[model samples]
Target: MTGLLALAAFEQPMKRFAVLLGIGSTVCVVQGWTLAAMLFSLPFCVIWAYCGWLRTEPQLKWLNLMFAALYIYGLARHIWWTN
Candidate 1:
């Protein structure tokens, strides 16, 4: 994901927005604000992926699903089933 973001920096005009999402997610994860990140990233990535954004190769196509699952799991674990 970091790699993709780095690549986005080089070739994407939308990199600034992507960077916002990425950094926001990273900060939420580090701060254990899982639900906040999940709320932001799930919809963001889905839309970002569907719009042919990111400009990634075919091999990385499944990244959207992976990111969705990540947020789902994080929300479930951190917010729904908290310790």
Candidate 2:
């Protein structure tokens, strides 16, 4: 799964959005924008999770599912508490 993600970094289609979103997420994190970073990464995680499901890859599927859950939790917290 780790190797798959590494190779996806160089592969097309996946490369296009994944790499850009990854960089954007990193930039947001560096700028101390936690919510923005999660927003950027959420789609990436969801997409990979779906791909993992389609491919029947449990590790990738569960890992991304967990990440997506965390991001959702964080976003919900930010939204509910920031008001």
The numbered model that scores best in lDDT is 2
- On residues 3-74, what C-alpha lDDT tens digit does candidate 1 reach at each position? 556644444445456668778877888998868878778766654564344555443446776777887787
lDDT of 2 by residue, 1-83 (tens): 56555655434676468778989999999999998999999988877776786568899989999999999999999999999
Taking all chains together, each candidate's TM-score versus the true structure is 0.53, 0.78
The regions of model 1 sitting more than 4 angstroms off are: 1-13, 51-56, 73-83
Candidate that scores best on TM-score: 2
- Give the count of colliding residue pairs in each prediction: 0, 0
lDDT of each: 0.66, 0.83
